[model samples]
Target: MNKPLSILAVYIITAVSADESEPNIEEICRFVAPGTTILRPNTCEQWVRCPTAFGAADYDDGSCVYGLYFNKDTGRCESIENVNCPYESNIVKNRCASKKTGSFLPHPTNCKSYIYCQNGKEINATCPNNLIYHPTKVACVYAKQYECELKTFPANANPICKAIPKNKILADTKDCTKYYKCNKDQQLVKLECAEGQSFDYVSSKCVTQKSAICHPLAPELEPESDVCGNADNVHIGYIADEKSCSHYYICNKRANGRPDRKPLHLKCQNEHFFDINTWSCRDRLRVQCYLDRCEGIENGYVNVAGDCTAYAHCKNGVTIKRGKCGEGFNFDERLQICSQQNISYVACKS
Candidate 1:
């Protein structure tokens, strides 16, 4: 199995906290309507029947009998002759065979597992616990440290896309807060507007519900368990992880880009980190993270990094709560209050 990773990245060298790459039952079962059947990462021999309740509880896990493999496309266990499981494995092996020594290759079917090429040898390795093998840092870390470029979809689910042009957002008639878009693949992709906002056709943007147009969502439109699968675009090959300063993955533009290589996760080696300016992992000291908006002060509310109306309540320099002021009110850094006086502050645009 491969280690897991999360999508949220903080630059403070804090503990890794995202779970996207984790093989936990909850993460795997997320985003789809209740009672969906899904595959476990990396293996086609077993499957997990998703539950109606969120997370790990109320789900079923089962495996195929000997000589049979679970076929997600078919939603059943079938004989090896009738499945692509072994063929996919062969592809993985062939990919790693031609890579340079010390190269890491991603397991095509499992986010938690990766292939390591060293000294003219290829080896299958799994990250420890919920940690995922980061190809850039070349180490194992938390989920919040990486994003899976792979988009996932239900194997047997009906297509969610409508007969619309690709890459355009369309308002839903059923739910004012939600909208749909056609992806590169012309799949009906659904998305939600931010809180208190609605998709407005007039302005073609998400705005306050009162000011935006809204329509009810259709009941037939089920949930997209894997948001990435319906995404308009994704980083295709070995790519830098914009979410984490220390992590990177192989999502090369051409998918595999090089036939001798494959998508894999990597992280900077010890005492090294990913430098955004240079766009690669470098010496630790070379990448200094001063992004904490609450860096040194020992308490109370503080203005967020770039928003004047937004503030964070801090305790011992850690943010306990975050909030935004109503329109016309700006955060008063000195008073730790939201006030109307600094509404013209030019620095809030970010």
Candidate 2:
């Protein structure tokens, strides 16, 4: 019986420990209730209300509640009644509650004047005559530092009313052809374009010469007209010479602009042939001629003379023979003459 009683006591102690370790669901839910939210993990508190409230009527009692001012004259709490405060106000323990001031509010119409609310009153302020209030800087600054919007003005009018740098060009408002440049004394000096030139607004410069219009051709030959005038009468697709059809010529109109004007002649080089499609010179294999036999005594060839024993050769398209015949003969190519009797012939070999 004693052993059973000790076991029962141990069981009861274990049951009590388990029950104490369990979480309280109802207490946890109450701590998160509305108007009594949980401030932290273990803290549950409501937001505190300031004793003094802005814009509250004064109470009859001398003592103010909710930290409001008890105004004796108005018989109420000092309120933000007459204060035209642009910004939020602060509440103090004293009945006199005033909005925070010194926040610069620029005047809508005047760049020099600014206003601020202080002690329930709007106080106006101004900068120096030449200075303007800068909202970004929150201070007064020279007017030159401000970049103001430009307004419409008459032709050649200097609306800036300030000194412009020398040699600066300014355009006229009413006329596109007129312009002015600032002189050393900051004075406007009118200027105009030259006789044959026109003012180019896009480039802001005077264009003195006009581009010549020419007939279009292949891309490679498009600029040919500029150099050689116009392609009019030349053979369109033939080589210039017979030796090798590599170099080709093109006839271009003269620059005199006359219908009877002669066309200019141009040719490609030796290693290139004129391409009709591209109208440009293209590379090609150079052709050459070589002969191993003599016929008709062609240029640069050696042949047996009419005498059957003597030889004559052609050089530079002209036939030439040895000054004398082989041992006992005289030969003349022009006379077709050869004889052994004319041994003393000075024109023949000795």
Give one digit per residue, the lDDT tens place, for model 1 in 1-350.
12232321111112222221323445434333446565555565677777754343688889887656677656788654345552243123244434578777665556677877776466788888998766567777788998745423223221222111124355555566676554454334568886446676534467865576443223332222221222245444345454444566654443332221234557877545566566676753345433443434477776665577887787765677889999889897667679988543322335
Residue lDDT tens for model 2, 75-179? 344343321111112122221225455555565447787666676456778997778877678889888887532211122222111112123343332233444
Query: In model 2, what is the error at residue 343, expressed in angstroms?
Result: 45
Model 1, stretches more than 4 Å misplaced?
1-23, 90-350
Q: How many residue pairs clash in each candidate?
A: 37, 14
Top candidate, metric lDDT = 1
Q: Under the 3 Å rule for N, CA and C atoms, how many clashes does model 2 have?
A: 14
Query: Candidate 1 — worst ten consecutive residues by lDDT sum?
Result: 7-16
Provide the RMSD of all predictions against the true structure, rounded to 1 decimal: 27.2, 34.5
**Alpha-carbon TM-score of each model against the true structure:** 0.25, 0.17
Error of 2 at 120 (Å): 19
Candidate 2: lDDT of 147? 53
